[model samples]
Target: MGTSEFMLAGLVPGIAQTLDVSLARAGYLTAAFAAGMVVGAPLMAALSRTWRRRTALRAFLVLFIAAHIAGGLTTSFAVLLATRVVAAVAYAGFLAVALTAAAGLVPPDRTGRALAVLLGGTTLACVAGIPGGALLDAAFGWRAAFWVVALLCLPAFAAVSRVADTPAGGVTDLRAELRELRHLAGALLLAALVNAATFGVFTYLAPVAAGVAPVPVVLAAFGFGCFAGITAAGRLADRWPGHVVAIGGSLLLTGWIVLALVPGALVFLVFTQGALSFAVGGTLITRILRQATGAPTMAGSYATAALNVGATAGPVLAGAMNPFRVAAALVAVALVSAVAGRSGRPAGPGRPSRSRRR
Candidate 1:
């Protein structure tokens, strides 16, 4: 969902130009998709309370296919935006339910490992899908990208069908789950801090790259770094689940700080960004899931909500300042990661008791 959400972002300007509209109006297409996700994620989680995890995943893929088709066929810009909205909602639903389900597939000892793999699906999509979509859009048209997405969904749907159902059981008590999360205030605060810090710099990655290198080369480097970084983080988590959060967070912080200060050294900046992305990308997501497994479904849903909140806020935060000023933001992200690491001691044996005092 995240990859698909982002894949079309690069095309928006061109799309707007083609439609003969303002860039801001063109940008609304992206917003419409996000709006759909905001509406769909929780609703899907709540509705799928009775279904097994695998079942929900397959259903979500089916929806993905349908939404892509809708997007491919649309004519007017408004219709395209509406299709994107529907696609985002469907993607949100898939994400919310899929993570909860994935957690049930592994042993408690390696829950972090399992969650890493689940989240990896999205990361991998970003790695391969976004660039691939861009190339396809360039080769065919922006509409062709949607057709490709629809085609991609066929295999995903089939693969999801083979995974055995492992239901978390009982209808979700979303209200009660929200109430439980209040006890983990420290973790939540840390999550917000991490988001603000990381995104502050990341939202303006393009500009930062432009300052250091040409746009095309910098973007390619950034994508590669993110892809490599996310995969590496997942490996680190599997190898030493306890230390990944700290190691990853620290590296991410350092990377951003470097990129912000030395905008002229493209090679160094790319390496830093990749390393930082690798560590932080894996650490933040995996850690959040680890903290929230007590109410896996609701926790996953809430985590997604927090992610959206961060992504939405990042641009607002970045937009308020000169792009060069973002270096400070990366440093702040590192601090948040460090603090979160301090509090993120792993739970042993059974799920951490929600009733136990934090």
Candidate 2:
């Protein structure tokens, strides 16, 4: 799902050419996907409240597959954009339910690690899925790429269908859940900040690297680094979650500072990009999920929404600035994370009738 959301991103030129539009116009597809996720997360979570986690996941996977198939068949750019929005809905829904299901399968202490494993697929998509989509686009046509994703979803659907028919714990009291999450509002802000920091630089990374290394090569390096960083962070999250976030954020901030000072240094560009990706990947997500105990779907939905909000906002805001000045956005990200870390009031297990006095 993550792969599908991003698959068309680097292929904007090809899509625009195929759809008979300008490159800038094709960029709207990316924005549309983010917008869908932001809107879909809570929508799906609330709507699917009565379904089992596995059931919700399976439904989302099927919808995702259908969306891609529709995308492949569409000639109109508007239709394609609409299909991508459906794909984003499925993507966000699948993620929210899958996280909830994964947590249910694990012991309390192991939930973070389990989520890491689940999300590893997203990072892996960066490695294999998006690149594979790009290759398919090059060899075949843009539509062929969508067909390939539709075909890939078949096995995932089969796997999802086999899970037990257990009920999703309960329906969300969205208002109450929102209230509980507000207690940790600082953390959600930090999550948004972290995503904003990464996307601010990442959205423009191809241009930055085009001046140094070839675009494909730098992107490949970035993908592998993402996989490596996430795997490492996942391994450490169960026992050392705080340390992982702190060290990762520091590295991310330091990398941005270097990039700001040394505009187009190839080595810094590659390494710092990796550092930023590492910081934003698996570790922080796991920690954030762990902080919310009741209403796993709601927590997941809220977190997903926060991330999409930042992801969408970051690029638009950064694009308005001189691209080089984007580094200042990362600086703000680092400071926000630092302040969030300091100001955080811990959320404890179970929903409280009245807010717990700390």
For all predictions, the C-alpha RMSD in Å is 4.1, 3.7
**True-structure lDDT of candidate 2:** 0.73
lDDT (Cα, tens digit) per residue for candidate 1, span 1-358: 5667778666776677777878899888777876676667777777776788887888878887887888788677887788787788778888877766666677655655666667656555645555676787788877788887788778878888888877756465767666757645545544555555545555566766665567666556656666666666666765564465556555555655554566675556665555555455456556666766456566666666666655566567678874334534644655665556455646556646434523
Measured by TM-score, how close is model 2 to the native structure?
0.88
Off by over 4 Å in 1: 195-203, 238-242, 322-358
TM-score leader: 2
> What is residue 40's positional error in candidate 2, in angstroms?
0.6
Tens digits of per-residue lDDT for model 2, 59-85: 899899999988898889999999989
TM values, all candidates: 0.84, 0.88
Question: How far in Å is the alpha carbon of 13 misplaced in model 1?
Answer: 3.2
Which pairs clash (backbone N, Cα, C closer than 3 Å) in model 2? none
